[model samples]
Target: MATGNETQVREFIFLGFFSLPNNPVVLFLAFLAAYLAIVTGNLMILVLVLVDSCLHSPMYFFLSHLSCLDICISTVILPKILVNFLRRRNTISYKQCLAQTFFLIGFAGCEPALMAVMAYDRYAAICRPLHYSLLMSKRMCIYLASAAWVWGFLDSAIHAALASQLSFCGVNEIPHIFCDVPPLLKIACSDTSVNELANHITSLFVGLFPVLFILLSYVCILASVLRIRSGSSRRKAFSTCTSHVIVVILCLGNGFLNYNRPSAGYSLEIDTLVSAMFCIVAPVLNPLIYSLRNKEVKGAFRKVLNKWTG
Candidate 1:
């Protein structure tokens, strides 16, 4: 039995901000500016981390990876958005849509685990400063970072595989800006019980476990910081963790709010705005957050600037 929805839905048409004002030029300019800023900001961080010996520590290494992840996540979708604005075409092929969805899921999943690793790094630095070098050795950092990225890709593969098996025999219109698990699942005409269940399960792998680990590490970190006798020493110790905490909150708060929720609250406009926050806005903010808040990064930026100018 061939359902009409299954046979006809070969492509997806995105109704992107179409109902807002119907102005593609304004949208194109805005998105172009954002895309340029995100690329330049993240690229500066990447280049500095690579070139500066002062930033060769485990923290900066992980921060570089975080920068790379932000670049990747934002890049995966922004080009298409830019194309849509310029060409006035918001259509994505079935295969391309799935590929986009896969990369997005993989990168999004990697953040929590990477953040957890960073939390542990901070914990090791403050809670066990004497053992920081031995505990967070070069090999160990590579292993942890590699595991996070691999797990993210594997998790994304599983979800994409399952979603591919689904029969999207209904309308090919995705309510939001891009192709995503929940949005894709929303349009499926076939049984999505299994797919949705898989979506739920894989998300825990992506978000919950790592978040718990990060929280646990922070608790230990906070306890250790409290024991510092001098006010300046305490502030110095606490300052290192503060930016990470801010980033963690921004990442996890926006992330879990949408991905971790049930489908009952799904609104098209709301989802678009929220997705833009984490996907588009967060990446742009990450580099600024790291550079402005951390003295090391700021100092390194000054060194680089002076060296180049000289």
Candidate 2:
């Protein structure tokens, strides 16, 4: 299968933050701290959800899943970034690149669907309280969470398989920070129409559809909240949904900005910043948003803390 004058690309050199004005050590420290915070914050959410008796309901069930996803998504990208910063070289072997691409997309893809499921949970709670038990039974919650995980991995498999087939023709420099499909395709010497087509199609179904579902669910949630007669009851209903709404907006907005760059494309620094925001900052913020906004989560944390101290 050897082609004339064609060499295989075994590794890719990342031109990400290396060329930036800041010191690499400084960047590494900042990212390291951020990664720790992401892990700590999300881990707290996970433990509270699992151990707190009051958080056993469907809403917190879905929050636990989201917390897991945030940790996973950050792990897939940030560790490599930290290593690269310390090594003073940004490089990933071909196999490692593909693997990273697989898990990164898999975890990132799952969040939207999970959030949509959470929206449905909220919708069921507020819009159909009498039937909420029937609508979000324990078994139903498990099935929904399972489906979201499966959906993300299946989508990622398609892209990773297609990406593996690409012939880089000894061109292995990726313009972006991570091993994303778009940057890989840009540097690929082979025909990328298929990969591009697949990306576009998945963008529509995997990316856009879940977001639309979340929006519709929120619209219905808004209507239901407004219909509540008691001012206190209305405020309580709105408060429960507020954290989820802020998180969905933050995650989806960053994702949109990252993926939907102008056709001409931004400068490399801008591109890198956008990628960092999507992959790094978003994960760090998700737990913080929930912890600060939700009194229930705070109470859960306090209860656990007091027990430990006692």
Candidate 3:
């Protein structure tokens, strides 16, 4: 019953980093260092948030969860990549590929929503200082975080189910380093028009909608900051928002570049780099940006460091 153009493919070969002629050892060491930095940095932040009493606020709570998510995100993708680099072959099974794709989509979709929640936290803090605690209550924070996780799981399940339905009866050489939706769909033997359309619409909801919410929340935050009468108060508010703003720009900018437009005729090389940034670099840098720049986080770090070392 097989057609001429269709052939069953069981595994995908990842064209991993350094497809060109280069020192594999050097690349492995470099990525290992980056991976270690990401792990230790995010782990430290997570512990600090958990142990430090002063960091038990809404902001730090969200940050701790974000750090946890970063760890999961990196763990899902980086170790395999590093292993592939170490080994001569870059092969992932069909099951592993599907699992990677599922988790990647889940976590990637959750990040912006989490960021938007953080933005709303900042808005409540700055714009309505008196009622900040009341607005971002413990219950509310838990609810928001639960909603994000649930939504991510739901979205990932939908996409993965759709992908599972498609028959991969063609070449299984994935152009990118990991299993991505567009690339996988390209090799499907059956009609993928429905899958592509669903991806587009879901990308709009998961990607752009959260970004718009974050932007709108920050616009209100900025407006409130400008209205403060005291110069010191204004400066303090601005400083508090700066770290989140930097993260927002990096995450949303790359997200827009990657997901906003249709995947038609996109360059594989550029997509690979962009995926690396959002998946690896952003998670690594997020904890660093907050811990290094925010005095409160630095204080918590010092306390946690002293307690552990002493």
Candidate 4:
């Protein structure tokens, strides 16, 4: 419990769906399906990346990490949402809330950086093919992937540390679904100037900087792709990038909307939907995007299936 001059809040009530319909069973079933799909889809990608010889490349190596992050980001938020759908009240203990916030923000922060790394992987493959092996060596991949995860959780640790210092003072109603720094800050009765400042400053590094990196990487990639004179070569090069590009757009777009929501004008339902898009829909779609777009992934899936059946 946070100690302050007033009574401390030990738990928080989620107002995520308070403004929506009164059907718990329907909501429960719906979210359960989403969670299952998220796990199954991302897990398939991860397993394929591990087992398929054809997928043992820098691109797929980074993709496997992206799949893991997608699963983690969804798992951090969705299970709690599913459980709350069954309960009479949508609530989380203060400690649980903080833990959720930490992991959710950690995984969420990790994804864009990871995507940027994946873009760099693509950039190296297409733009610097002569040095692709050296640029994305096994050790290099491990280091870049580790850096993304560390960057995310380190940033998350800072936010979680700041959040822990906040004195709720009996005000614990979080306006959104899961525990996040923004909603938590909204309910904090103490002076939140420091938290807000940290949030904005970190948003630059954690959000904007990586996004800029991705755009720059893609710009270089597009230029390189265009320089290839053969139409077939251009198509093949573009095909390799389509899946990553779509996944990046979906994940980053939903995330941007989720985090940058305006302070006052939106309704609770809108808030809930936006968070769901980020936490639920994006994860579920990523594997499908790759599977459908990438011939390699589909062939790997077929190969795995044949081994299992035949």
For the record, the alpha-carbon RMSD of candidate 4 to the native fold, in angstroms, is: 0.9
Residue 92 shift from truth in candidate 4, angstroms = 0.3
Report the Cα lDDT for candidate 1.
0.86
RMSD of each: 1.8, 1.3, 2.2, 0.9
TM-score of each: 0.95, 0.97, 0.93, 0.98
Candidate 3 structure quality by residue, lDDT tens digits, 18-119: 454567777678768878888999999888888889899998899887888888888888888789877867788888988998998888778788888999
lDDT of 2 at 258: 80
Task: Residues 215-303, candidate 2: write the lDDT tens digits.
Answer: 89989999989998999999999988989899999998988888788746478888888888988777899889988998888999999
Runs in model 3 lying further than 4 Å from the true structure: 1-5, 16-18, 260-268
Judge candidate 2 at residue 112 and give its lDDT: 86
Ranking by TM-score: 4, 2, 1, 3
Q: Tens digits of per-residue lDDT for model 1 on 69-188? A: 998988988899899877787888888899999999899888888999999999999999999999999999999999989989999998889878777655788877888888888777
Better of 2 and 3 by lDDT: 2
Error of 4 at 84 (Å): 1.6
Each model's lDDT = 0.86, 0.89, 0.81, 0.92
Predicted model with the maximum TM-score: 4
Give candidate 2 misplaced runs (Cα > 4 Å). Answer: 1-4
The parts of candidate 4 lying over 4 Å away from their true place are none
Pairs that collide, model 1: 5-169, 6-169
As for candidate 2, its clashing pairs are none
lDDT of 4 at 122: 94
